[model samples]
Target: MARHLDLEEQEQLDELKHFWNQYGNLITWILIVIFGSVAAWNGWQYWQRRQAVQASFLYDEVERAAVGGDAARVEQAFKDIKDKFGRTTYAQQAGLLAGRVLAETGKADAAKSALQWVASDASDEGLQAVAKLRLAGLLVQAKDFDGALKQLTSGVPREFEPLAADRRGDIYNLQGNKDQAKLEYMKAWQGFPADSQYRPLVEVKLTALGVDVQTLKPAGEPAKS
Candidate 1:
């Protein structure tokens, strides 16, 4: 009986060795690849988190400088943010905020430069549109009518189209191009949403331009009897 048990154990050991011979290297390689991928993913996540944390702290500095109304400090803080975290959205936001503060303080050249950075380099389309629009307004104030018109000609997000048209209308009016001004004003009035808060402002503009808003109908809408 002991001899028979010894023979059966030997047979079982042989079977185990055969299985390992068939799949041992494959299993070891599969586990090595999986573990390597997990390590890489974790390392990437850590890097991203570190970047975000650093960017957030810098953004806080920018906000504080802005609130204090220190244009020079704001500009400096924005520069730091751009240098260190230009890949972050905070840098773009800093540009806009700093530009607004500069513009409010009558630093047109500085404001224009800041806004130009945001308009050209911002990753977010909405922020880019806003920056471009405000930059155009400053250009208009500086009497660079052609430059203002050029800024307005750049494409904006769909939501800003009406406002862009209205701004363009103003620029044309300033340039004494009444016909083009009227055309742009009509476009603004027509493009604006019926329920928009901005619609009334657009209405005022149209009224000033001798275009009655009440007489206008929705595009492709038939006239009432």
Candidate 2:
């Protein structure tokens, strides 16, 4: 019985040796790859966290400068945010605020630049559309009709169509194209919903153009002409 037990133990030991000899290198490589991947993932996560923290600090600075109405300081802080955290939503928001403040402070050119950046490169489509709309309005104010038209050409969200059309009408009116202005005003009227608060404004525009929307309404719902 002692000899049999010895033989069994020897057999088990030999099988383990064979298994190790067959797969030892493969097992070691698999472990190394798994640990390396884990280490890389951890490193990437740490880097992302650090970047977000840094971006947040810079965004706060932008907000402070904006609130104080310090255009120069706001510009500097916005530049830092754009340079360091351009991909962050905070940067986009800061850019909008800076653009608005700059325009209010008689820096239309600088405001256009900031709004153009947000319009062209912002990750959020809605924000991009807002920037484009505001930029287009500024261009219209500056009498850059061609540039304003170009800005309005891009496809925007459904909610902005009326505003775009209305702005286009205003531009056409400025150019003394009353016919084209009426056409755009009609389009704005059609694009607006019945319950929209802005619908009345569009109606007023159409009225000024001598087109009564009430006469254009279909049945007996609301005068969305």
Best by lDDT: 1
What's the CA error at residue 70 for candidate 1, in Å? 0.7
Give per-residue CA lDDT, model 2, range 67-100, as digits (tens). Answer: 8988888889989989988988888988898899
Least well predicted 10-residue stretch by lDDT in candidate 1: 216-225
lDDT per residue (tens digit) for residues 1-225 in model 1: 999999999999999999999999999999999999999999999987888788888889989988998888888888898888887788888889889998998889999998999888898999899998999999999999888878777878888888899999998888888889888887887788789787788788778878777788655665343
What TM-score number comes out for model 2?
A: 0.80
Pairs in clash, predicted candidate 2? none
What do the candidate models score in CA lDDT, each in turn? Answer: 0.86, 0.86
Supply candidate 1's per-residue lDDT for 76.
87
All candidates: TM-score? 0.82, 0.80
